[model samples]
Target: MSNKDEAITIVSNFLEASMAPDPELAATYMAADVRITFTGGRAMASPQAITDFNSGRYAWVKKALGPFDWTEHEDHTVVYSNGTLYGEWPDGRPFAGNRYLDRFEVRNGRITRMDVWNDSAEWLLTPELNQES
Candidate 1:
């Protein structure tokens, strides 16, 4: 497989492990010095930190994964994963169609950086927008 394909697979596997809430497994796909930035510019040092943050913000969550778009650079591959998030919130409110976009930098078969953005904050600010009308 090409480096691009491998990067995609690595990212896909990591996402699966993450949704499984298996931080140890997820960590396997990331570099030891991985940099992760979530919504609100929260910096995370490791996969376990991500799980902890999620646990606080969501009762349970999973991604409705979309296509993986990538660009290969001289030393690393930049991959973008765009999709909607579906899950229950901390308040036990089930929500769907919360769009999310994640950017990852994969180098030498491991993800070195990740940035995440999502619409959950907007939904939270105006919960009536998430209510079934």
Candidate 2:
């Protein structure tokens, strides 16, 4: 597989494991010292930290996988996955269609860096986003 294809596979596996509620498993797809930046600009030192933060945000959450857009560079492959989120709030309200964009930097088949951006924060700021349907 080309570098871009490999990066896409690696990221797909990582996201699947993460959405399986197994960040520990997801960590296997990452570099030992990977840097992760979550939505709201929180820098997480580890995958477990990201899981912990998500636990507090919603009772349970998972990524609804989407197509992976990959860019191969001279040094690394960058992959962006755009998707929606589905889960329940702490108050037991279900939420879906929370758009997310995740960017990953892969080198030698391991993700070295990940940056996450999602509409969750914007949803929080816009009360209409939480209305019961």
Every candidate's lDDT:
0.94, 0.88
| Each candidate's clash count | 0, 0
Using lDDT, give the best candidate's number: 1
Per-candidate TM equals: 0.96, 0.94
Which predicted model would earn the best TM-score?
1
User: Whole-model lDDT, candidate 1?
Assistant: 0.94
lDDT of 2 by residue, 1-133 (tens): 8888889999999998887778899999999989999977899988888889999998998888888998888999999999888888887878888889999999888999999999888776784885542
What lDDT does candidate 1 reach at residue 33?
Answer: 94
lDDT per residue, candidate 1, 21-68, as tens digits? 999999999999999999999999999999999999899999999999
**Model 2 / residue 127 / CA error / Å:** 2.7
* Cα displacement (Å) at residue 52, model 2: 0.4
Candidate 2 — which residues are off by over 4 angstroms?
130-133
